[model samples]
Target: MDIYALQQDIIRYSKEIGIDKIGFTTADPFSELKARLVRQQELGYNSGFEEPDLDKRTDATLLLPGATSIISIALAYPSKLEDAPKGKKGERRGLFCRSSWGLDYHRVLKDRLTKLEAYILEIVPNATVQSMVDTGALSDRAVAERAGIGWSGKNCAIITPEFGSYVYLGEMITNIPFIPDTPMEDQCGTCTKCLDACPTDALVGPGQIDAKRCISFLTQTKDFIPMEFRKKIGNRIYGCDSCQTSCPVNKGHNHQIHKEMEPDAEIAKAELIPMLQLSNREFKAKFGHVSGAWRGKNPLQRNAIIALAHFKEEAAIPTLVELVKKDTRPVIRGTAAWALGEIGNVDMLSVLYEALEKEEEQEVRNEIEYAIDVLKNIE
Candidate 1:
């Protein structure tokens, strides 16, 4: 079998099946990434969401025995929402980042990878293959960068020339000695826009992220957002887009080529107040399809409370009051109390005082008391 011809055939097949970009590279151990992960762990910068096994994460051979090459594929997602709804004075909305806008890219990319895997196995009957999307052990960006899908941008995304940084990446490791493509040179020379735009200084340096401080990571957490970053989070419910939106390379790169990857404007930019009241079952029906729903509705509900506070919407007081007084989850009740304080409604003091009287949870009690103090000072 002609290896180069087979590689070209795979690339053509990838495009026909909706893969925007495809590149091949040797399954060499990612030694540099191993060092970076160690440094990240040492500095307490890790998000705790990543696969914890460092050796498995950096070595493709561990995942698939006799792995000789890796194929990286990228699917471009729509960056801009054409008919996005506008929120009024009383009604505010929260944004899920551009990446989470579509039918979860994981499923989208997995379909393509499954098809590619079957095609390869059919031709090379003895070829060993394994595939993964974001949840996989290997760093998707690192794989894509090495495979020539794009250069690793300053914001830590693979910035493809054709698709910019607005692309979803996935990879397949196989024992097929497909010749490797050349890696792209760094194109983010002297650019500080992504670093400067990071809301929480999560971009510690070019291509280095302190994930703990990142709004995207913070939003996914089940507990309270740190006080310092709450204001920075603003109306973002799931992920933050400050870095990606500010990049000059990504300015005009909205790709709507894949129909399934397009976002529902109403769901993507959802109303903040309505989010707080969603039952777990109701939440799943509405948002379960999107990637942002992975953490479930509690985190998003807490963020909605924070967003309502950010807006200082007097209209949300009743809803926030409801959450503070009767919500079963301590995080929800406490966050709502804090939002009530942030809203600075002197009148809400009575409602908080009433909740404090009945509240038993230590954290929730503290939050209610703190809110009462914040409101009392306004008098």
Candidate 2:
């Protein structure tokens, strides 16, 4: 069968099916990806679910057994001018990162890729198709880079010229061999903007990330966020986009805006006082469909308390004290106690003092006592 013509046909069909960029590469990720994964695993730097078995996914013999070609795809989620938040300073304002601002990429991409797979079968008559997004064991970024979709930036994310790093990636593995595209060169020369802009300094070096220190991982992680990274999380209730926001490559690229991802208008700019009041049901209704849904509202709610504490918003004291009494998670309680201290509200002092008496955890008690000290000083 003619492979070059098939490649052209696939790329053309991908565009028609809503994918912004498409290219082909051999299933092999070469040595770079292997070394990176090895180093990450060696250092025990993985987060978000148990660390996956890398060998099962990366070894071609294990994945596809006889895989010959990889069809890498990118779907763009552009921002719209009208959808931008009204002001810069609010708890729940502005757009989310371009990648997750609309219908989940996993939902949109699998539908289109299924169509593409059907087209491929028509051409070859006998071919195998394996589809996956970022959720898979395969490295989507490495595959995209090898396919000439883009080069990996210092952030270790694929950076395309047309779409920057805002696009979600998917891939189709097939037995049919096609002429592979040449890899792209690293274009982030002397640019440390993403590294500099990170609040927690998660980007430790060029193209290297300690996921433990990353705010995105911390916010979504099931475990307790480290005590040090607490206040630096700012007002971001979900994922942090500070690094991407600072990248020059992402400055002006406008894709189709997904407005559904924006937070509700009434409370989008509401102060921390109200955010701490959201019931579990209320939180689910507001943010359930978003990426942050799985973590529920407790972390974000706790983060709001921390934000208020950082600002010394004494107005949030009543709500914060209420949370300290009712909240069950020790990590959340510890942070709330710290926030109450930061606000230094005398009204909360008795509550904090009482909470300290009942508190069993040493860490939580320490924070409550600290709050009591601040309240005593203010009194």
Candidate 3:
């Protein structure tokens, strides 16, 4: 097959599979990305993907032997109203980044990539094929940029004019040789909205993320949130989208307009009290199949407690009490104590005192004492 003809076929097949944007590139990332990844690791920004063994990742090469090019695809996950909250007065529109409102991207992309791989195999019977979503060492966004799909935004996300930065990236590494696509030039052009909109200053510079200060990381993390960012977390129970939301490209792509993905009622309008009440089994049942399932209930529950505390809603006191008294995870209990302190009520002193005595961990004990002090002062 001639290179030009083959490229056209691949694009047709990709669109047939429901992908919104397609781009191609040879398997070499520029030196700048490598340096940034190293710096990010040094500053503890890579903890999310730093596990000892990541099966889908490969660094020696983005492709197998005889590999000549890559086929990168972008899929759109439009926001849907079903994901929005209901009957909640004084609540800000529950903000879920448009990208995560639907079915899990891992499953969606994996299924689409599998189809692409099978199609390629049918044409080149002995062709080697490996697919990746966000799982691998391959830089999905970098590859997308090289493929001419879009320019990398200041938020460190791929920005497509048609879809903005609200696209999921996936790629296929192949042994078949093909012509590579020209890379796109940066179009972000002096725009600092994403940088200024960041609640945690995760975007230290253009295209640079500390991840350590990222709200997405904070909400997605398993450990207790660092005290510095707890108050700024707002009502975000899962992933955060402040930077993207503030981007001009992403302004009109909310549930009121786009309709590809639907949000869960519970998640869209997430009630701090109900989230606190979710049992382990219920938590799993509700979020297990979704991307939010990874951090399980602890982080989300913790974020919810903190959000309620920030809201200063007296209604949340009973829920916070249950968490402090009986939640098995000390991380949750400690955060519960912290939230109680922020909410500040006279009755909470007794609860904080009880937790302080029973609290075995120094961190939780300290938080409990702080809560006791705050409550006493409020009284």
Best of the candidates, TM-score: 1
Descending-lDDT candidate ranking: 1, 3, 2
* Candidate 2 segments exceeding 4 Å error: 48-51, 79-96, 257-275, 376-379
Give the Cα error of residue 311 in candidate 2, in Å: 3.3
Query: What TM-score, to 2 decimals, does candidate 3 have?
Result: 0.91
Q: How many residue pairs clash in each candidate?
A: 0, 1, 1
Q: Least lDDT summed over 10 consecutive residues: which range in candidate 1?
A: 319-328
What's the distance in Å from true for residue 223, model 1?
Answer: 0.5
Q: Which ten residues in a row have the lowest lDDT in candidate 2?
A: 87-96
For each candidate in turn, the TM-score is 0.98, 0.88, 0.91
lDDT of 2 by residue, 114-172 (tens): 99999999888878878887777778887888999999999878899998887788988
Q: Across residues 68-177, which tens digit of lDDT does each residue of candidate 3 receive? A: 67788988765445534553433422234445565677888888899988888887788887788886667788778888889999999998888788788998877676
Candidate 1 or 2, higher lDDT? Answer: 1
- Which residue pairs clash in candidate 1? none
lDDT of 1 by residue, 1-379 (tens): 8999999889888888988899999999999999999999999999999999999999999999999999999999999999899998887998999999879989999999999999999989989999999999999999999999999999988999998899999999999999999999999999899999998999999989999999999999999788899999999999988998999998889999998888999889999888887888999999999999999999999988989889988899988888877778999999999999989989888899899999999989988888899899998
